[model samples]
Target: MAGPGGRMMAGGGPGQRSIDFKGSSKRLIARFRPERATICALLACVVLSVGLSVIGPKILGRATDLVFAGIVGRDMPEGATKEQVLESMRERGDGEVADMLRGTDFTPGEGIDFTAVGDVLLFALGVFLVAGLLMAVATRLVNRAVNHTMFRMREDVQTKLSRLPLSYFDKRQRGEVLSRATNDIDNIGQTLQQSMGQLINSLLTIIGVLAMMFYVSWILALVALVTVPLSFVVATRVGKRSQPHFVQQWRSTGTLNAHIEEMYTGHTLVKVFGRQEESAKRFAEENEALYEAGFKAQFNSGVMQPLMFFVSNLNYVLVAVVGGLRVASGSLSIGDVQAFIQYSRQFSMPLTQVASMANLVQSGVASAERVFELLDAEEQEADASPAERPDEPRGRVALERVSFRYDPEKPLIEDLSLAVEPGHTVAIVGPTGAGKTTLVNLLMRFYEVSGGRITLDGVDIARMSRDELRSGIGMVLQDTWLFGGTIAENIAYGAAREVTREEIEEAARAAHADRFIRTLPDGYDTVIDDDGSGVSAGEKQLITIARAFLSDPVILVLDEATSSVDTRTEVLIQKAMAQLAHGRTSFVIAHRLSTIRDADTILVMENGSIVEQGAHTELLAADGAYARLYKAQFAQAVAEVD
Candidate 1:
């Protein structure tokens, strides 16, 4: 079964697929190993900030005590000692007031002490100010750490792509792969940035607030924790339900992206075929699937916050009731109860905050899973050390009993052998899927042969690094590829070393592309997109041929190199290829029987084997597969002319 972001596994949707929460979380954290130093600094700042914040409420509690004491103390006789005033209240049947008064340290003759209170308030303010400053620093560190981690991840992804075999891409959509590299990685970064620092702060605040609560009054502390189990239940239940949806959401995102990319790239074909409505219907279906998955994921996770808030409010009532009782019973001061109330809030808030962020954390982890899957995919076999070089570049290429298959049960090419001597041009003529392209692929090492081996200059090609082997060969296929650059730069891309402007122009002239290039507004300097937007199909074909010419390869392989060009241009390209083929080995795969009559060898391939091979004249005289194909093309041409 193909996994997420490749193709959906058959018979399994999001609900049927469960994620390893602990495993994904651990792996995601492991990606941050390079940023550990920055993380340590961030943690230190958070710890200090939370420590000071937890202390702030306690300091304010002291000021609260002073004011309460002043009010009570002012009602007592001015001349009396503090003990006598409390005794007087007890005797007068104001026993509850006396009990509450016992917990405060107040002078009977005094009122509010503004100066002392101001000092306490100022110290609390300073602590909070420092805490905020430290948190700000921590946030900056968070950004730094996350950005660095993301940068490395992108680099890793790019490197992995280069190392992967072509088959990996063949089995997957370009947009899906791109979504994992771009959207998924970006999501992971945003998730970490949004949650990491805040999670740390919330947790530290919880711990610090718990300690302060215990210090203030154990009874009230126990009261504030009464609903903690309930909060945990709500969080886990909602989180569990939402987790699958998050996975599905990302999966759907990749699928939708793949559909959109496929459609956009083939939009011209769709319009030509009048399939616009059908395409829209398919797009709508994918979009709705994404919306459904996203909506369910969000709605399920969204339930956590309100449920957590309910638990917190319940805890609040318990603390308030128990705290008031403690104050009335003289077991705790009013100011202590007030501070305990703030501590209860501090304790509940992190739990609530974490619960609310369930969706973000879940979403990020889902993206992390996707990215890790890409990274973990089996890469192509490592390139070997270069084989011992031949005495010189002779380009004598041979394949002995090469076998290959895209699927194990279906053999596409089996036990194939071919040899081309140095300085010879070999033309391969075959119907579609007859392994003409597959043969060249094996030669280029795009796909390794399943059995036996291929050799260049008497050295096993597999023993050499892929780059080392392919660097000596030049390829121009019917489907040309050009990057977004000027015509000069695009052509120059073929050369392994820097080339002079004269050399570039000469190569273009050789390919018959120089005339058209010179007519453009900027000549060879005119820029084009990767799709070669400014050039016609045949013009693009000519530029690619020019590119191949610039490479000046030791071995040239052309697969329908002139398929896009007009008859006049095809003749010109053929002349250029013939000149380039001098003193080097050349392999041409073509369907046009007329173009390759002068080749030193003509190979007729069918069903992955060479059915007939010789000079074109000899094959025609033999009246075999090559002659039959040639006669068929001749008849088609005569019919068209008539």
Candidate 2:
């Protein structure tokens, strides 16, 4: 849904949106398929580890019984059978002690057997030690599998982004998309790392401990089972309630990040327009929204732990009381009752742990959904198979009744027909919202033409692969983009193959960037960031021109390429561009009329139509739209000069 400022909100909006928990969690698990072997090993470790851990309490019970039986036997007289001593005790009206003693196996007059107790204790310790070792191994395996899955997911996202159409990015904030790729993915990884192994172990432990509990005493086991349903209900209800908040939390994060990115990037603009307070207010609003979403998510999920703990304590008390009565009746031994109590605790601990992890799982799945949404996004149309190319590879391009619209209902470029001969310079000039750049965009197939076919040397461009079409063209856009690299590397970026230092320098010289580069601290080797921080706007423009120069493409496009440069540099660029355009088809979209007075052809565009077309002198003599634009610009220049 669209929100204020046309920002998209998948889950964070005025009304909270429910998450597809089951589907998203299943998809997240499916991502680990490539690590199937590791997962299987981890499961093996967990199963064996849990088996040993469950048996440890039973073995410890034997040790307890040995010590306890010795204490009971030590109080009895020698030379009498175990039944005789118990019968005498009952006769003396010590019936409770006698009943409890009937379950013990010990020699009369024997004291606590330290040796037997030590041996049993050692066995129990060994069982637990091995279990702990196996659990550690399982943890390592889980980490490996989770990390591998996350690595592949990142790769998939990166590959997916490259296939998405320009329009997809045009409509979305860069930061919003970036959050999916970085923050959301990272959150998922962290959650999985923290929860996946433990969740598996907790589940297995519950099953194992439940079995042990039933083995010790079925009655106590039944008592422990009473609270199981309650724990599950608590977990599910709290999880469901908190899930939407988790979804909103991540959505708010993306929105806040998008706002911050926009504000930071345009901080100078905000200050220039004296809108600092407005920007700050907007930030506070987004920040507050994120805080609320996060708080609610945590609070709701947070309630699960204490509630589960309460249910577990209730189960514990019930088992303890019931086991005591069974021991008193001689139905179960004291050691057996003790072991049953331990089993009950083990069972409840997993339940409590899983309940506590409800929020973490919800949060992780929320992030996974965001990433899956990106992966599921519609991609650009596939490239043509058995692609066609221009036979002669000349720089001739023609738009035959081409039409296009960003919105299907609103046309931007309609029936725009034009043909450029090999090596001719065509200059496009128009007011804002004119179809000037849109024409170049179609010619390059940045956008598919809606109504008619655009062709290169008579072969329809749509029939060719985008890479094949773009490889033949070099463009210097009005808004320059420079990756963080040396100046030489930036210039060489236009070339398809590796370029030499001398060649890079020669291209820079042609674009009039070499002089300023040499004046910088590290000359051509100086590195700038993505935003071209170290270079002036004109210098950035010059570097882009240099990049285009290095490509030496058959077709060239300059979209206000010299708009930032001073008049002196513009004259130098014009001279260099003339030499560059000597035998290549060139398309220049210029706002400055003086720059294209000598072009072979001039087009005046307005509202998606070519209103006038001629040579500069011809159009000026005809006194058409082109003449008026030129005259207006000339008067403006005169006024500025005065």
**Highest-scoring model, lDDT:** 2
lDDT of each: 0.90, 0.91
As for candidate 2, its clashing pairs are none
Give candidate 2 regions above 4 Å deviation.
Answer: 1-14
383-452 per-residue lDDT for model 1 (tens digits): 6654555567789999899899989899988888889999999999989989899889989988888998
lDDT of 1: 0.90
TM-score of 1: 0.97
* Tens-place lDDT digits, model 2, residues 1-642: 444665433344525667788999889998899999999999999999999999998998898899889988898898888999989988999999888778989889889999989999998989999999999999999899999999999999999998998889999999899999999999999999999999999999999998888888777888999998898799889988888889999999999899999999888899999999999978877887787778889999999999998998999899989888988888888888888888988999999988888888899999999999999999988889999988888898888898899999998988778899999999999999998888888877777888998888888989999999999999999999999988899899999999999999999999988999999999999999988998999999999999999999999999999999999999999999999998999999999999999899999999999999989999999998988898899999899999
After superposing all C-alphas onto the true structure, candidate 2 shows an RMSD in angstroms of 2.9
Cα distance off (Å), candidate 2, residue 487: 1.0
